[model samples]
Target: MAKIAFILLCHKDPDAIIKQAQSLTAVGDYMAIHFDASAPRAAFDRIRAALADNPNVTFAKKRIRCGWGEWSLVQATLHAVEAAAEAFPRATHFYMLSGDCMAIKSAEYAHEFLDRRDVDYIESFDYFQSDWIKTGWKKERLVYRHWFNERTQKRRFYATFELQKRLGLTREIPADLEVMIGSQWWCLRRRTIEWILDFCRQRPDVMRFFRTTWIPDETFFQTLVRHLVPEQEIESRTLTFLMFTDYGMPVAFYNDHYDLLLSQDFLFARKISPEARELKRRLGVLYAAEGARFRISNEGRSLHRFLAEKGRIGRRFAPRFWETESSLGRERELLIVVCKKWHVAKRLVQRVRQMTDIPCIDYLFNEESCALPDLGGIQSSVEKRHRHRRALVRMLFDYYESDRLLVCLDPSNLDLIEDFCRDRAVTRLLEVECQVSDVFLVGHAMRVGLAGDRTPRETLNRLLPTIRNDMVHESDRIRDAQFDNHLRLREIDPPETNARAIAAFLGVPGDTAETLAETDHLFAD
Candidate 1:
């Protein structure tokens, strides 16, 4: 039988930590907790008194005031691990946890999962080779000494970094070791833990180097593990499930994520919001009831595929799966017509149809839909936006049996705009930005049911942000369009453009292109 010891690092919310400890105590595994010195002493006492009766729970004597991206955190972890080792000598593995973490599965399952694998489970990505750090420096962090805590002392932190960059000051990294980066949380074998502690004892200079390294907690053990452990025996991924935003911030899991969490088999999840009381209660019930609430999505069952998406985009933002690589839009030429408003897109399509023989259709996405397009086989469905969008493109071409087709879209339909703009078949794109005159603003507001007993100026003030955001999104898409080799894109904002390019794309004589330059009045009525 494999014995697992837990090392928990806690800084806040004693009640939650105590609850976690009670659950772990019931599991009969020894757990060592380290409370930050910065936290109230009353909190530590409350937690300690609550868990005093549990023989398996122990608190580290040395409390360090931990600041984010500071060396104190690693010190705190070291103390907790040491305490856990002394308290439970027969421990086979050490699993790291935080106050925010909760076990998703039973303790026996964790032990059995570890028992089946002789390999050490920890995320240790090559610092230079992999893009493990999303928002932080990679090489500079290891090479230069960090002087201040980034989160608390932002000014000094950046100033010192800039000074180091300007002065070309760098610290010497141990040439023998490879710089590895990973989540600070891990499940390590007893041998790996002993080796790391022993190596630190022998290599005091290496410890001294990392003491000043930026966010050493993330790299200290991760980089050191590779020095002793062979690559073949190390599983380079975490047992804990964590998701980060594009800005490299961990998203706090809440009640809304319960369905998503039931789908994953990861041992634990971290950074759970303390305010998520319902989520916490449901999770407790899930384990107590043996997962009566656990259910896979309909899409996952019916489509014979995992319905969940990746990152926060899938977990929180989207309701279901979106297959970008669906076999619908393969090898087809499409002309994208877009506007901020569906009314503008609809009218723009009408104008394009009159000007050219190319087939143009409207209402790709009209969320505040007043009148939906009655076109058969090409109407947009929210459930399958990509499928319906590709169908619309196909219908236009198949209806005319032409090589290319045109489809109109609203930029305000944020979900579909980017995908279509960068779609492989999108060889041509035209975006119309209707100039918001006083009359048009009022008319647009009234049309969209936004104008309610307000002056046109007030409507403009209220609606300017939406229009501005749409324009900004459109601008970003057009800027990104240049990178897409297949895309030939243009924006008719302020009714200005390169006449020759517009003339060529529309297949119209440049001399007769007055309509292209003065498009502000197109929706003024």
Candidate 2:
């Protein structure tokens, strides 16, 4: 009887829930799924049938019909909370999960982490700045101004620019706390779930907002949690936000910002991709990499190897957006650094100056910068000098507010640098330490062990060749066999057999056999 009641919301994608449930089996887990009433009965029936066979699963009643822009999602989840409370009354905690999310940590670590936490691992958010209220709160004064005001819809056609300028927002709103919505994904203690239900039920006005609001699902729950526990430690950056989406979301090393997530530190990433399926198969390798302390050389070396292979033709290839020039014909500026020992920063500045004609600067800090040669000094004072030099490094970065390409040579040390740049709206930051090796493919490997997504056969055809040609070539051993095996399968196997073989080979992230099989035609001539 694990304490965490994993409550899942299943809508159109029963497969996602099924795969998620199946993956949980490795961690000694049980589940409760609330299939939305709007979902096709046939699909819901299939899921129910599967749960019948799975001892860990308890199918929840479909009580509410949730739509994309409505409050039904909130209502449905609340119903699930009620159902889970009644069904698993003895459970210590209740984790609210989506069908698509994949657990990032193993059972032991997750249990231990939850056991120690005092408050619910959940938060609420709302459009506190929206105009409908016409209240005293100046929309401009709120922290999430841009997110509430962004014209994603064409409802008002007049005086928008004039109004924004009057409000004192001169610059284009950058992606910040205001622009981005909170994650629907959350973990909560059982008491918290019960409390939320009681609180929302106590105030029907909160639930009634569905009739007038859009995407209330995103903010309602977040707002409630923040109100209930103002001082509780909350992480807005969910376990899912990829530290870097610039590299087209491939396997890469974790940086400092990721440390916040590591603190909660579950085993699986949110929304693990089919591309990363094979990598997920090797969880032992991934867990080790995720928990590793800062060691520059090791990370740099591993990165170099992985990237070198990424440049090869055996695996799938997607051109990085950075490689292309802007519509203005400006060369996309990129700062790439390989931090070896001392003097690396000096060389970086020199290279940036020489490589481009644009405004360029770099700062390097080392023992040489000190005026007093520590010939007679002890080791402690020498270390202090290095510390002072490190502090000076921030000044150079502060010179530019935004619109600069900042690259750090040692990515293992990138966490601190990334946090510094994230708040600034004008800078585009890229950190490449070394390359990725097989260890970078740990999630893909774990998907192997889990028996990955059963995507359709046709989808695999077009996708497989690219993966085999571009991404998979890094590991000659796997590449050699996989290439031959894929060719043979194309010639002999039907969609189902080929799908299984592909899953077996790639160990895809979660179960996507049906979807992958459909892609088979794309691979054909």
Candidate 3:
């Protein structure tokens, strides 16, 4: 029988942690917990009292303060692991979990999985060999020392890094150790844990060096385990599933995400929302059920890739409200197809689609009434759009992923156009201005609003020829004079010239221009 001990990390949420600790209890299993030293002693006392009846649970003798990307997190983790080892001398394995993590699979599944494998389960990759370090200074973390807290004192953190760069200050890794990076979570064999802990005990000087290194929690055990254990015995993957959004922000789980949690093959789901008692209760029910099984599926990795793909667009959004604007991805070449009419944009999108494989998204803001699920084609007003206009425009940009993308823009989307032209770094903004608006459509809208009856298809049926002829006649001069100030503007003066105009603006070859011109049937009688 495999004796697995869990080291649970907690900083706050005493009630939640107590429930989590209580749920994970088993007669044979041991849990060693460490409340963050910064949290109030009263809160810690409440949690300790709540689990006092459980003989399997223990708290660290000394707690440590944890800061994001700081060395203290590693210290705190090791402190708890040591406590677990002391409390359960017969423990054969150590699994590091946190208050925000929950076992998605059954305990039997985890025990069986561990029993089948003699090797350790952890994510470890060579610093230089892997592209795993998604963003920020990679090898620099090992080479230079970090003093300021990345989250709390960012200015000082970056300023110090810059100063170090200017001074050419560097550090050397010990000869025997090759640095590796991985997630803070891991499940290691008892002997492997002993070796890692023993190595830390022996290497006082090395420990001192790691204390100054950036985010050592990710590297300390990860690098040491790689050095202490042989290659075959150390699996370079974690049993715990973690998902990150743009810029490596970890996604938190809520009760609403129950389906997604059930789909993961991994033993545990991390960073649960503090208030997700219902989610925990539901998962807890499945966990204690008979005939529980460990499923193998690509959904975990697929979901990650899916979110990453979504993150590559101009914007990335999460359930958190702040991410709506904060998580914008790398900007790409943006071509704004401007028109007052939705049909004109639709026709241009069709022509553009015919010409190139580059993604051409249509009707970013549809002027015509749009049919939505459970509702008939409804017209949205300027006031309704203004409420969530930024999110609305940004979401469309986020849907299509490409190095260069073209999107049809309503003339009403001026704020969006202005925003794009302003703050974008690598993005090049271009515009195709369609002079396709006519007075006939304007009259039709008024008729619909006042008379409560208007047939656009039949009405436009008769006005097509007249609208085509008057597309850029003297009736439009005053309305069109102010377009010169737009970023990289190109014009479609007459209905017949849309194809050629778009081709010329995009710098397409002469032959392609002719092909595009053949698409003028988009404005046919």
Name the best candidate (by lDDT). 1
For each candidate, give its TM-score against the true structure. 0.60, 0.45, 0.59
Model 2 vs truth, CA RMSD: 20.0
Residue by residue across 1-525, what tens digits does model 1's lDDT show? 677788999888998888887776565677899999999999999999989988889888799899888888888898998888888888898999998887666666666778998988888998888888765577888877887988888899889989998999977778898889898989999899889888888998898898888888889889988889999989988888777644557768887655545544577777678888888876654433331432322121211111122112321244224444643355766666666555656665576677667766566455424334445734546444445655545555666777667666665444565555556664556655555554554555555544433323432464556645545655565555463422222344333354454555555776544475444546543
- Candidate 2 structure, TM-score to reference: 0.45
> Cα lDDT of all candidates, in order?
0.68, 0.45, 0.67
Between prediction 1 and prediction 2, which has the larger TM-score? 1
Worst 10 residues of 3 by lDDT: 370-379
- For 1-525, candidate 2 gives per-residue lDDT tens digits of 346667788676676566677766434456778888877889888887876877557766655766664556777777777777777666676677765455555566566666775666543433554433333433333222222222333343124534665776544322322322355667766666777788776766555433334455556666666655444555543433223233434334333213222323343444444445443344323332334432111122222343354444332323225322212112223232323221433343344344433334332222333333233332125344233322222332333432333333332233223323332223233211222333323333223221123322333333334433443232333223322222112423466764564344333432453344444332321
lDDT of 2 at 269: 49
Instruction: Report residue 268 deviation for candidate 3 (angstroms).
Output: 0.3
Instruction: List where candidate 1 sits over 4 angstroms from the true fold.
Output: 285-525
